[model samples]
Target: MKKNILYLSLAVIIGLLGGYLLFSINADSTNEDLTDNHNHLETTENQMWTCSMHPQIMQPEPGDCPICGMDLIPAETSAEGLAFNEIKMTENAMALANIQTTIVGSVEASDEDGIISLSGKIAENEENNAVQASYFDGRIEKLNVNYEGQKVNKGQLLATIYAPSLVAAQQELITAASLKESQPALYKAVRNKLKNWKLSDKQIDAIEASGSVRDNFPVYATVSGTVTEVIAKEGDYVKQGQPILSVSNLNSVWAEFDAYEKQISQFNKGQKIKVTTNAYPNKEFDAVISFIDPVLNNNTRTVTIRTTLNNKENLFKPGMFVTGKIEGAIHTTENSLSIPASAVLWTGERSLVYIKTNPNEAVFEMREVTLGVRNGDNFTITSGLKNGDEIVTRGTFTVDAAAQLQGKKSMMNKSGGKTMTGHEGHLGIQESNTENKPNSDLFMEMNLPVAFQIAFQAALEPYFKMVDAFVASDANQVLALAKTTLEKMKAIEESHLNKMENSHLSKSIEILDAISSNSDLKNQRDQLVVLNENIVALAMNIKTPSETLYVQKCPMANSNKGAIWLSTEKEIKNPYYGDDMLTCGSVIEEIN
Candidate 1:
């Protein structure tokens, strides 16, 4: 009975030990799970937050972006393995931006010639220009052509003149006609004298047949043409051989193009040129270089190139802008590689292009390219691009924008940094760095007459008034202000300005004149954008004594291309957006 009790005690002790070991294992597992949960919570708290619109902004805590006022989101933890100069974009974004690429290839031999592009205007052919002059000292009794651009036909009656001399001559002719048997030479002299006055032989014969003197003589058109100028008016006394009117024959016109010194070498007399005009975009007019001016215009540093066009249809009008392309075997070679100009982006002195590195994926890398001569719509790639390389032809600006947003190498930023925030990071918000500003040198060397300074500053007042009108969204007021500004600009003595300064002022006035003609606020604003550039250039060259000028920039203007205007005050008043965004600009520079 003692041996049976010992066996039961051993069994009970072994079962108790097994139960304790199982409980310890379960407690240790519960502690380990709790430790893992604490670690995951710590990691979630440490994730970096950043703004989506401004990817350059990063913070440890969630907040709004200081630059664009956008809420911050958690940054992606995975690193995007991209090169410093490379930018990756989704296919959908690329399509939405209208990005297009072209594969560079060898140009055909027939199309390898370099073309020279020139800007010019249609003008009257000097050879076809005619002047109508008075044949005798007389008073114009009646004028038929009232205004410029009136068309007159050959042998058409143009005017009536009352000439006492012609009446006396006619009386002498009658007397001579009676004495023709006795004084035939006198009679012939009288007739020849009337002929000298441009009287038709038929009219002279009719006068002699009636044996009566006519009070007034009729003037006829010698050539058929459009009257370009009316030199004389009715009741105005004119001397013999005095110009009465000027006419230009529209049967032929001259397409006069300006060629710079560098481009003049590519042109030769009789070279064939293809001309295009905005008025008739599809039609190409073929012409030959008739003449090239031997003298260069010092101010423009260009020479006029003339090409005659048969304008029998009168399709081309004077003052119409034209683009001429001269294709010749000038600077073209079989080994030359040319790309569309759209593929190139210009940032100061650097010319950059986006190179497609991957065919399957939408990957683009910024490349610095050396440019040669531009031929029509294409630019010759001197280096950095190969014949078989793929390049971004269209939407290059869009690509650069994306690169800028992603902190990749871009046109403005060669070595990309984290995206910038705040007012300094906004596009077109330029801070004045007086020490490094390009125009700083110009300011140091500038010297202007006191009169010029006062006049130029006064001119800005009208422009500012116009800006106020625009801010009010008053189209009529803008129009009226534009006219007043134009008159003020025109009244300025341009002779006081040097050649360069005068040229800038003239361009400004031309733009303002364009603004005056358009009552549409948008059109006026568009013109103002260009006018602002001219005024800024003018202000930079001339001294503004005792006056402070503010150079304001609007990034949202000109279809988002951005523009700058000169203002007298530090306050922002945007003319481009008018009342909708009257204060959508920042002061970029201050000129004193």
Candidate 2:
């Protein structure tokens, strides 16, 4: 019995040892699996995060975009992703943004010359202008040319003057003729005196034959032209060498274009010009540059470039507005790349464009380009681009806005926010703080009348309403408010104000009228920029105590040149950007 018990104990001990060893091995394997799983979770949590709009921003954890204040998304960890400057867009995002691209190619060179556009007025050619004057002292007479603009011919009877001096001379001639047989020299002297008085030899001969003196002598036109001015009436007595009328030959006319100081260098005498007029839209008149005025108008800072155009068809009338174009050398270098003006975004002196870096993908990168000259709808590129490159031509502004949001290289942010310290000194805010503050003594200096002040204040109400509409991004409301503003402005009579005030009011009305006609929000906003400038001028020149106004500026507005608008409150609600960038501006001034 003792031996059987010992065997059972040994078997039990062996089985327990095997079970303990297997459990220990399984525990070590389980711990290893748990460690591997924890590492995988850590890797997922530490993935890089980036903003969809600002691709340049990268972070170790998911968060929001600092620039645009948008939600952050996971950045691509694959090696096949785009480079630092390049931005990738999905097909849906591109369609939503309406982004379009164009494949660049070499444009065929042509012999056509570039055009230099000019604005001017049709004026009378002073060289062809003539003045009709009386040759002898006269009494009341019959005038043939009744009104201004009357056509006259050379030697045509213009007037008949009843001159006592002429009658006396003729009587003397008759007396001299009677004594001719005895004194021939005296007869010849009288005849010569009559000839000097503009009397024809035939008239002198007739007077001698009839032995009578004429009561009146006829005056004839010295040149053929249209009557420009009738200086003296027929009933009024005139002295010898006194101007009666001014005539201008309409066969030729002068086109006087106002050339800015910068454009004066492009003008030269004998250059061919093609002129078009509003009166005859289909017809184009050819002319040659006759002269460029040596003196520049100090106030206007412009010189007059005169071109003589043939007016044989009588189509070009005086005082008509015209546009002249001169063929000249192109401002751009040969074989340079040219892109549409819309494709460029200007930031002060910097000009930038978006180039498609990848043909197979929607990848774009911002590039700074050197601008040469601006053609009508195109701009000549002097550097920073090459042929056969693809670029964004349409919706470029939208693309730039996206780039700015993504913290990429843009017109406003060149370093792509890599060194961005904070938003404490934003461009719009900084400019508003220092530059455009209203003067406290501005109203005190203006000696405006009370009645005129009331009228000006009333005109600002509709303008305020329009500002609210733009803030809300309601285009329909903007249109309605613009019309109401225009009506109020037109109702303000200019006669109530003094000369300077009237001038300011008239300009404001004209700009408001233009704004009222445009239904497009962008166009209306552009005009609003000018309208606000005029309002500021008016406010500075005239006191309006009944209302308080605020002048705001958006450095990003008007293609980044910056634009100003009038507001009722100190807070900025940018009219230029509407909701796209609602808080993109700041209050610059306070007016009362």
What is the lDDT for 35 in model 2? 92
Give residue 272's error in model 2 in angstroms. 2.9
lDDT by residue (213-243, candidate 1, tens digit) is: 8988989999999999999999999999999
lDDT value, residue 86 of candidate 2: 70
For model 1, the superposed segments whose C-alpha errors exceed 4 Å read: 1-121, 147-149, 171-191, 205-213, 231-237, 257-265, 273-287, 295-304, 313-331, 345-370, 383-392, 396-592
Measured over all alpha carbons after superposition, the RMSD of each candidate to the real structure, in angstroms, is 12.8, 14.4
Clashing pairs in 1: 56-419, 67-422
Compose the digit string of candidate 2's lDDT tens values, residues 1-592.
8989999999999999999999999999999889988987876765556556544444555665543456767766521466776766555446545678987654445544376567778899889999998888996589989799899999999999999899889989999999999999999999999888778899899999998778988888999999999998868999988989899999999999877565677778999898998778788888888999999865345688998888888988887878887887355455777787667765434678899998988778998898765444566777888997899986575566456544577655678853221222111100111124332222224456776677777878888888888887555577678778888888776665654455446656755665655444555665566566556656665454565777677877755546677777777788887666888877766776
Predicted structure 1, TM vs. truth:
0.55
lDDT for 232 (candidate 1) = 96
What is the C-alpha local distance difference test score of each model?
Answer: 0.74, 0.71
Q: How does residue 116 of candidate 1 score in lDDT?
A: 74
